[model samples]
Target: MDLSFLSEQVLWGISVGQLIVAAVLPLLGFLAQSVVRRLLRRVMSRLRKEGDLSVVDDVNRLLTRPLSFLINVALWNGVIGLLDLPEEPLSIHSWATTLGMVALILVIAYCAFHVVDVFAGIATRAAEKTETKLDDQLVAPVTNTVKLLVALIMVAAILGQFGYSATGLIASLSIGGLAVAFAAKDTLANIFGSIVIFSERPFQIGDIVEISGVEGAVEEVGIRSTRIRQFDQTVSILPNQTFTNVEVRNLSKRESRRVRFEVTLTHEATVAQLEDFLDSIRHSLAQRTDLHPDQSMVRLTKLDTNGLGVLVQAFTISTDFAEFMVTQEEILLRVRRLAEEQELPIMPAKEVRLSGEVGEPRSS
Candidate 1:
């Protein structure tokens, strides 16, 4: 074989060899990272089990992220060196290309891992601050905002690494702002709405609230809207911005659920019977343990030509809506039974006098 005559074929062979070297090392690096991650996780788990750490320790654990990142970067660098390209222009180009690919992978992975760490730290700090309650609505948005910012930075860094100026990318986005704004107007509105809801905290998830005249239990509070489960078992989606401008009634925040209702007395009932009726209502409410028991009051709030209006007021012992309704029903039923026992008319009264008397004063 004339070896000098096979120049082109020799170059092709070298290229194929370089490709094989580059491919195998990165695969090996990935496998090594997986093994290393598993080992680290196991060790951490063991340490967590044996160590005297308070159950509330999430901040210090995020400290592991930088070490994990360095390890991953080292493995990637090892793969690049294994390619073993020459110092010549062609070989340098190949090495630069290979390094670019490795760097891109490392950058994406590092950004993702760092975001997780940041989010974990955020959650830990939030947990430590509030003991009796948590502002959980904040975590998702705060973490997501950090992740999105980090991702954008990573992308810009990657582009800059490829010799594309990141400043130019931002400038380009600025120039395209009008179009972007027009296209994403609704999305921006939703984002603002999310911020308002998170900051104002008109109502939280699992709260029974009434907004825009619709009453329901809040099922979820999302970035763009909120989900409500109505009493009829239907789910309603309300734009988050709607809450920003509308008056939101959070029923859960009421200190005492007030029960206000009017009971009617018959026209034929005497004044003595009305007093007896009022007393019976007060006594009936006193028997329910679910009610405040101490604050029960009944009075003749109104009297019309048609009937006597007895206004009953009581405070519930619980904020729970279902229990409040049950207590209310029990009180109403008891009042009804007492009224019947005293022969107090339960229906609204209407006296029939001649219409001729409407415009004329009749002598008593």
Candidate 2:
């Protein structure tokens, strides 16, 4: 180990000691990066065991790599400056500085992305507390939009490092205004569609709705589309713009579901017998608490070529489909027993395509 060699010039007044320092900084930087990353990972692991938090995963994705890159770039920049590298024709110093700036911009954007996730988590918690599901639907779109803006700003900053005027280009619309407009037309329409959905509120998240012949429970309402989970467990994604000028039937909004059925009698039963049977059926439905009080009815609605038709129609107070099915089944069983008691020859009407006990119950 000669002490004189340590002070000997290596290049452009930079010593062997400085070159050794240059070589050593990167090793230290690398070690520091791994240690910090491991520490953060350990912290995240502890958090995961305590409670479920969305931001835990967000921090790992949005902070780890960019932060490590930032540390590496900073160390690299320091080494380039320490050597006093030449700036003529091509310069490592200039390259390092530009790279560092780009790295800084990226790290900042990633931090902003983490902020967006944090905001989304806060918004989601708040939305869950409210009664209206409309707020719940709004969280994703707004968060995604903000994240997208952050990404665009990050790109602009990186571009600026290379001497591109992002603002001037945007102001001039030099990329071709018509082309940009055409490109964004659908996106603009979708944004407006989301606005209309929020304002008009044809259906909320979790509502069973039928739109454009597609029926399902709305799983999510996003800026561009709506995700619907159908009865068969298949998901349907419809463009938000589709809601603008279409009919949407909110099945959840109904006060009651209609219960209707038609039964035919062989001409064996006379008018008086049929009348008494119908009255018994009406009276039976009226006594039940599940069926609507005023809506219960049984009448001879048709005098057809085949036979006399006894039509039964009522409404159930509950909106639950499973409960509605139960109510319909009870009514059908009751109607059958009543018809048999009266000694009336009854037959299920072939014309009743809805397939109910008395008739298929149609929702109203």
Best by TM-score: 2
Residue-level lDDT of model 1, residues 211-257, one tens digit each, is 99889989887887788999999999998878768889999888778
TM-score of each: 0.69, 0.71
Question: What is the C-alpha local distance difference test score of candidate 1?
Answer: 0.72
User: What overall lDDT, based on C-alpha atoms, would model 2 receive against the true structure?
Assistant: 0.85
Encode model 2's per-residue lDDT on 36-80: one tens digit a residue: 989998889888987766657766766687678778778867887
Whole-model lDDT per candidate: 0.72, 0.85
Off by over 4 Å in 1: 1-49, 52-98, 101-105, 108-134, 173-175, 348-364
Q: TM-score of predicted model 2?
A: 0.71
Top-scoring candidate (lDDT): 2
Residue 20 shift from truth in candidate 1, angstroms = 17
